[model samples]
Structures are given as C-alpha cells and as structure tokens.
Target: MKLTKRLHSCVQLEKDGRVLVIDPGAFSEPDAGLGADALLVTHEHPDHFDEGRLRAALDANPAAALWTLRSVAERLAPAYPGRVHTVGHGDAFTAAGFDVQVHGELHAVIHPDIPRITNVGYLVEGSLFHPGDALTVPGVPVETLMVPVHAPWNKVSEVIDYLREVGPRRAIDIHDVYLADIARPIYDTALGNLGRTDHGRLAAGEATEV
Candidate 1:
C-alpha cells in the first residue's frame, strides 16, 4: 500500500484501487484530495475531526464511507445514513479489505464524557497501527505505525515509550503542532540509525510505500 500525508493529521492510505483517509481535520490542505474509500475518525476533537472537511470529502466522493467512534457517528449518522458506522472500544470491523481493531481511552479526559467517545487506535490488517492521539501502544503486531508526535498534552518521552512498545517495521510521524520546530530534528536524531525507522519527515503531499 502507499501512504500520503496531508496538512495537519490527515493521511491517505491507498492500495489496489481504493484510498482510506484518516483524520481529515480542519487545517488540512484543500487540493490534496486522495479520493478516499473510507474515512476513519479516532475522536470528535477539532484537530481529529472536521465537519466542514468531512462534508467536502463526502461531496467529492459520494461513495466514501465513514468509520469512526460512536461520538462522531451519533452526530453524523442521522444525516449521512448508512454511510457512517459507529464503533467503540474493543470493536472490530472490516473496510476496504482490511481488518480493523479499535481500542484506547479518551485522551481529552472530559468529565462524565460519553464513554463510547473514547480514543481509538486501529490495527489495520495486522500490518499498520494508527493510534489517533492515543499515545499508548495496543500490543498488536504493527508493520507500520502512523504516530502523533506533537500535542499540547503529549511529550517526547511518551512518544519514545510508545515506539518501544509497538516496534513497527516502519513508522510515519503525525499530529504535530506548528511552531514547535523540534519534531524534525528530534525524529531524525532518534530514529536515523534504526533499521526499522523510515527516517523521513511525513510532510503534506509526501507519499511513501509501506
């Protein structure tokens, strides 16, 4: 499969004749469409889910389905009909020929929050793991991992710990905040010599094979 990074946290994973988009957030680049088959939203947070973008994407690709946590499903299912699937922690489902396992606690930690709105990490076809803002590892075999490198609540140490646990054959960094100006150097120095590390910045419009 081929993976391409869009602005902010959006990623397009393509294989065969389909594309799967993950977290097409508000700040994503407009013309960088990948003609998605399904969209995966890990949470309803602004940076992880954007209503406007989702609408645009759906308009662009009328056949695209949306696989997301219950919190997101509740909001969109009413309008989107069969296009939305509501998943929760421990749920397992398939889309676009890949097996998907969802797990993780809500990182935002809102009080009395919708229990089903918890954070989610997807184990895709037992090959790739996309832990959308859920910094912890899910203890599954991951050939490639799309990792979030920067957030107001996360740190470098946490990211290192996660990498050690997942032990993916290759990795792509994501969810970075602008102005930190530290991810590139840190990522280069930390994973540069590792046999498994991709050792490249996952900037918008860039594509890589996995």
Candidate 2:
C-alpha cells in the first residue's frame, strides 16, 4: 500500500490499483479528494469533510462511493443515493479494495462546555490505522498509525500516552496544520523521544510505505 500525506487531516491511500481517500477537508487542497476510487469521512467537521470536494469526486467518477458516519452521510447520501453509505463504530466494509474496520464513537472533547459529536477511525487492511480527529485505540495490532500530532483538543502528553497505548510499530503525523514550522522541532523531539516507537512526520505530498 502507498500512503500519501495531504494537507491537514486528509490522506490518500492507494492499494491494488484502487485509490481510497480519507478526510479531504476544506483545509486540504481543493482537489484532495479528486480521482479517488472511494472516500471516507471520519466526521462532519468542515476541516475533515468538505462537501464540494466530495461532490466533485463523485461527479467525476460515478462508480466511486463514500463511507462515513451519519452526520456526514446525511449531507451527501440524499444526492448520491446508494453511493453514499452511512457507517458507524463496529462497521466493517471494503472500500477501493481495502478492508476497513470502523472504531470509536465520539470526537474527543474540545472543551467541557462544547457538545461532543460523532467520530470514527479507520483500521485499513488490518495494518494501517487512521484515527481521524481522536486518539482512538483500535485494540488491534497496527503496523502503521496516522497520528494526530497536534490539535486544539489534545496536548502533547495525551498524544504521547495515546501513541504508547495504541502501540503501532511506526506512526506518521497528521492533523498537524496547527503546528507552526518553528515549533515542529519541539514536537519532533518530544514525540520521537517519548513515544518510544518509530515516529515520523511526512510533509504534505510525501509518500511512504508501511
């Protein structure tokens, strides 16, 4: 499988000549979801689920489909009909030739006053796991983890602990648009040293094998 890191929270995964995209949010490139054989949205947050980009992908490729939670599915299902499927935690499905296991139910609390919303993580092919906006433990061995290195809802200590708990052989940073360039070194050292596992950060558009 080939993993391509996209801007912000979106990522493009290719396997067996099929393409599967996750997130494709407003923070990513407008064409981030384009040319995908399938799409998966973890939540309805604008930074993780951009309706226009999804519409474009589906319009351009009629055979392509989308799998996501209710909030996101509701927005696109009406227009796409059977192509947009509503999925939640414990759901297992194959998208673009990749077997995906959905895990997690609620987004991490951003604040005590803010209401929590639905969220799901994807464990792809039993090897790679992408936990959208949350630090969800898939409760299975993972070869590669797409870790959210920086976010408003989480701190480095919590992220460090999450990484240790999930116990992926290796992890690549995601959900990191909030981390400024100068501050990157700070994260790099902290996660690399404290994570006690293989930790990596891929620049937007970089590709790596797991």
C-alpha RMSD values across all candidates: 3.2, 0.6
- Candidate 1 lDDT over residue span 1-210, tens digit each: 888888777788888878888888776766434377788888888877887777777778878788998778888888788999988778898877657888776664334544434778777767878888777577777888877776665666666667777788777778865525654786556654542455455767888887
Instruction: Give the C-alpha miss distance for residue 60 in model 1, angstroms.
Output: 2.7
lDDT of each: 0.74, 0.93
How displaced is residue 89 in candidate 1, in Å? 2.1
Per-residue lDDT for 89 in model 1? 74
User: How much is 168 displaced in model 2, in angstroms?
Assistant: 0.4
Clash pairs detected, candidate 1:
none
**Candidate 2, number of clashes:** 0
The 10-residue segment with the lowest total lDDT in model 2: 201-210
Query: Model 2: per-residue lDDT, tens digit, 53-114?
Result: 99999999999999999999988888998999989899999997999999999999999999
lDDT of 2: 0.93
The prediction achieving the highest lDDT against the true structure is 2
Give the residue spans of candidate 1 off by over 4 A: 31-34, 108-117, 191-199
Deviation (Å) of 36 in candidate 1: 1.2
TM-score of 2: 0.99
Return the TM-score for each candidate structure. 0.86, 0.99
